[model samples]
Target: MTSNGSIATTLAPTRETLSSSQLLSSSISSLNSSSTRQASSQISKIYRQASTLFLTRRLPESLSTILPVITSPAADDTNPDASPEPAPISRASRTTRIKVWSLYLTILNAIVELDPDEGKQAFGSKEWKGLVNKVRDGDVWEEVVKNGYGGVEGDVDSDVVINLATLLLAHARTQKVNQTRLESYLAASTNPSLDVSSRLSTPTATRPHSRSLSPVKGSGTDTPRDLNARVKILELYTLHVLLRNNEWDYAREFISISSVLDEERREAFLQALQSLQEEQMESERREKEERRYQEEQLKRDVEEARRRRIESEEREKREEEARNRRSEKGSEIDYGVEDSPPRPGSSKSRSSVKGGSVKGGRSLPSSSPTARSSVPAKNVKVPPSLLTRAGNVVMNVRKLVESMAGSFKTRPMLLMQMLGFIVGILVLLSRRDVKERVKSILGKGWGKVRQTAGMGVKVSYI
Candidate 1:
């Protein structure tokens, strides 16, 4: 006693409350009419009843009632018109067949959750192929496609493949079926003519869902949004399946050629991909920077270690030199003892001298060479002190200046000033005659400065 049964009883009281099985039987019984129109009308009625059953969750009964009408097989397990000849079916029958195919596929998609393998088998059965082939047999196929049957039109072959692929992809994604079936669907959907070489070559801003393109004429139409919804769903499912299979290139190509996706969706997809790329680049950049920093730090550490080693060697050399000097001084002090006979009255003095020398030897500085020489030399050179080297450097500079001053032409302005200073010193040391000549030159320079100033041109003597 479902709602449909209640509704059936209310519509026709001659029938008591019908069970699901009874309702299914009643729908199928009236479909055997001789008139084509009557048969099609009965199918339409059965389609509505099946839809109701589906809503009420009586999927098994709904499928059982719908499949026979759609398949129309003479036998239970085989298609009678496996190789359908050129049979002239009426326009109404053709349309009804198309509707039945659509409903069948829809019901199959819905019931996939119940029995995925059975749904797959049903889609692959000869009954399904026979229906599709029969639809394409005559001009009726073209007319039905052009007029659009059950919301599918234009690009019918590709759309059919996409829809089947979408269904299989859903089953695989939900783990209801093996994922390998998606590969077959993907292969069927891919057409060479639709392949894209670059993503940028594809349109970014897709047309809104309100418009539809007729594949045959490339004309606009106010078609229902169902086709667009299916196309987009297929694209998304195909993309997910391709990614899950690790078909990265195929996924990119699919998105590039996807005409059903809206602009915001495309942007979101590209943005997610772009963000992934950015994350990888950022990780690489950080790794490179870390490596570089480590290298620089190692170099600095090596240099610091080298500098410390050099300083340590210099300190050891200085210590060794001090020890050698102390040892030499001690030897000199020991050798300074006189070789004279001991005086009989000064025996105490001789003994005292011997004892003082022994005490001195024992009390020698620790830096003495005889104390220790086991320390190794580091073969380091000590530079001469600046104070000790300054006189030689000064003498060399004086020689260079003297040589260059032999000719005034080789002397710069600084050398000329020095020469003038020397000349003045020489004149001061000379007699009154050289002093008078210097005084005449200074008076002439002062006279020239005064003459320039009197002429209103400013001048100064250096």
Candidate 2:
């Protein structure tokens, strides 16, 4: 009985073991399905919230809300001390995945375009510069590829690719990296390892993963929608991006050889390319002309300023020379006056008679012996004869009369007043009583003058 029980335990399948295995498998599958659904719902919710925040112009909040949905967890994020990892984008539905990435790229573009102060205020200085640098340096493209497309460049969604190229074209400092990335994507997309026929014949279970399973609907020319998207991508690559890089010949060749475009579309694209080239050339010519005009204007302004400065300097110089000439002439006149002989009746002769020697009609310094000898002795006295004194009085009276006559020529009213006063005096004297009074006054003034003269003669004799 013991051997049989051990054998049955070893060989026979227990109902509990069978039931447990089945239950474990079902539970694992249910857990995976529930987790996928939860991730999808969460991504949709985050996308809606971020998009709403973006539309409302709340960029910082939108960036914060959408970052986790698009970014993968760091390698060290498994530690308890590390922040919790976000759900990988691959787990979400196709539509939700595209929406999340599109919102993220848009947020990045908006942040990059913000004014310096606003960007700094919205995101701190270091963070703002970092985000801007990511766009301008074309690192954002790499991030999208690595984080969103599982490091597969061709696996990126068509719409996402459009947004990436547009963002880089708008902000990147160089277009080489963008062009190379586009070419690689186009090469990978156009030259699929397995053609459409092969992929169709292959069993779904064994078929390798391709861009069909990407966030975009279909790969290459699989459907009309896919074809339209391909056309758009080609338009962006050949027209916008290649033009920016100045790859005209390569662009034309690319358009001509493209299998997707029909004859009509090809003709249209070629014509558009030609028109764009012409327009670009015209714009370049206009810009060159404008720059040349500005340079000439600037040169003219500088020359005009210089000319004005020189004229002002010359005017000032001429004025200064005129002033110097006037000063020199004045100085020469003064020196000549000091060195020339004095005139007979000038003030210099009068001054010379008092304190300087007069020889040859020139004044000499008083310190000279001749000047001392020429000066009159202080004690010398010479009395004038009566005739000489009477002659001097006559000359003074004549001078006074001549001065009065000259004054009368300039002022007729003053002359009239003087004449009227004289007439009045004569009229008063005409009266007998006035004549007798005037004769007595004259007799008394004459007696006083004779007495003063006698005293002056006595003093002179002594």
Candidate 3:
């Protein structure tokens, strides 16, 4: 009975394996059907089932089931058919492609964990680069750079693409495969140009291929959520690299971008940002202090120059005074005036002569007692010199005219009066009758004045 039971159990397992293979084959066939909606649903269902299988630790079965769905049949090159044939299938839709890549990458990661040698082989395979390129499509990256996030096709999920990119970057960094290319991919994902709204909402005429993607009935809430998720995932991925490399400043730059992660991570990012800003402010303040120090140094130099100039002027003045004193002493010796002592009575006469000489001599003016004593004679009043009095009269006339002119400058009436007086004077000078009449009046007044004065003088005598 025990032998029969063991044979029966082994046979039952063979049948179950056969049935599972059949089911997998059926699912693949459905996925490749002409009906696109049906194919998309089947692909989604296959991904879910494959993911469950992987979570349950059935790596082998999960890989086998998803691998067939992910791969398409290779073109028959040896069996050439000359007959008419339908066009070859285009690349899979974005949703279908993302699922297939996710499953493949998941299995690849498992292989890496379970078998390091196999993982190394798989990472080095040509398909590795190809898969990375598909996720980070050249055209999509270019569009993002040109037109921001809005330029990306609606079908492509930015979240999935970025996650795949993160995995590839990790692999490349570990293996030291062309760091320049991998870094560029990271730069492209977080490019500052990607700020446009996901819903471009442009007029239809501008978007010729927009009609190709059918609208989802209830995906309105989900669209924005997905976009936010994409942005958050990219932020976290970038921060992981920067933080791991100890680039605090760079990691701090993504504080706002880190909102997609949990609150705890966001707070960490915010703290880093605050620290960076504080550091920047400190640097700026230090620069300002340096500038202030330079300004103070310049002011000190100017003050030093001014002080030196003043000191130089004072020294020169002292030297000039000393020279003048020496010249005076030399002149007294040259004249030999001190050799003869003045007679007490003759002192005044001698001083008078010396003072007179000093007044006439080519010598600098002095504030000595002798000079002060001689000032009374110089101050004695004398008749005004003719030339001096005439010059004083002319200066007074000029001052009076200037005052009149100034007063008339603003007064039209005063100017007119002055002009009339000048015209009257010209008339009197030109006309003989007017001139003779003015002279006769003056002569008569003078004669009368003389006769009155003579009569008054005679009366006083009587």
Candidate 4:
């Protein structure tokens, strides 16, 4: 029974070991609830922070510096004898002329508070009026000073876009350096190129694991700015793109004015840099040296191989052509010594002259030179050397040997002829393989011999 219980438990999955579908469903519910709660808290916090900061009219951080009161205000404007009572002013509010600077500081802080990602956490939700009120308070200060003073030129209006943008910038940087990153966030959030509403509604581009904006090395990483300088525009723009999209890793690298990507990208930049330079004549010299070496080596190799192949091919072709020429010349050695017959008319003339002549004593008249020369048909002398050669050739054919020897006691002359024929054949059979094919074709049993077939040549003609 205990063993059965163990088996049952093993077969049934534990709650912790849920299938993928169950886990996904559960995780989804948990995430939705958590995000809703966080969102609610964040909205409330930002609103409270905005309210508090905007309401507090403060001087710019730079001019918080105080100077000793050198003179009192006129006690009286109407009477020549009395100076107006000196205006009551705190040390912090003593900036009689640079009041615009103070308004700018109030606006900057209010933007900082609206941004939840920044280190400052607000206590209430989504207070856009807080930013407006801040602007209004600034205006009121300018009014008190009796001049409509300008703070940062564009800071007069309560721009919803800029407010949210500044907040976005702060949020973006909160994950990194609050002060530095906040500006980056503002840039992205405020960019007309990127629609903040769309981004908030839909899934955004994933921020990389690292969101630092450091410069790369001499390898053309992002350039460093004094922060006070006006030329870091492109770098700042790229930084904004990186942070706003939340590509933390790439952003972090761009801002770091020191990171040298010791990788292929750096190599490419180095190559590009090198291309613009022309003083490296030494490089051209080195390349020319290498080319000359290759050319010389190639020339030598070409000469060596050419020396052998060219001569060898010429020799082989010459030999092969010589053999063909010789075979053709052999065919020219014809059988007939006096090739053409005497003219028909000449033969008739000779016949007539012979008949007319005294019997066996004189010819009737000397016929045409050619007719008279057409003498009695003489026997064509089949030279014994020629017969011997034919015999030698036939003997080389393996089957012809027995034929050359003839029946042992039956034909002695035939045997003599065959031996001579075989000897003559040795002179003609140049290549060795010709000897074997000849042997195979000739060396066959008498019963299977080609004689029974009339197509076989019986008479030997040299």
Worst 10 residues of 1 by lDDT: 204-213
**Pairs of residues clashing in candidate 2:** none
Point out where model 4 deviates above 4 Å: 1-195, 201-265, 268-392, 395-462
Q: Whose TM-score is higher: candidate 3's or candidate 4's?
A: 3
TM-score of each: 0.30, 0.57, 0.32, 0.18
Q: After superposition, how far is residue 415 of candidate 1 from its true place, in Å?
A: 99
- lDDT for every model? 0.52, 0.80, 0.56, 0.42
Q: Tens digit of lDDT per residue, candidate 3, span 1-462?
A: 899999999899999999998998677546544354554567677778888988897766676677656443454777766322211111334556556666756665565454444433545555444434433333223322222122333333455445444554554333122223334544443342333343346332222221223343222124666656554554544455454454566555555554344567677657755665577679889999999999999999999999999999999999999999999999988677444333444654445555643545654334344443453333558889999999999999999998888888878799888789999899777899988888899999999999999999999999
Q: Residue 180, candidate 2: how far off, in angstroms?
A: 1.6
Pairs that clash in candidate 3 = none
Question: What overall lDDT, based on C-alpha atoms, would model 1 receive against the true structure?
Answer: 0.52
Off by over 4 Å in 2: 1-38, 74-87, 194-211, 214-219, 328-462
Which prediction has more favorable TM-score, 1 or 3?
3
* Candidate 2: residue 21 Cα off by (Å): 18
The clash numbers for all candidates, in the given order, read: 0, 0, 0, 40
RMSD value for candidate 4: 32.4
lDDT of 4 at 1: 92
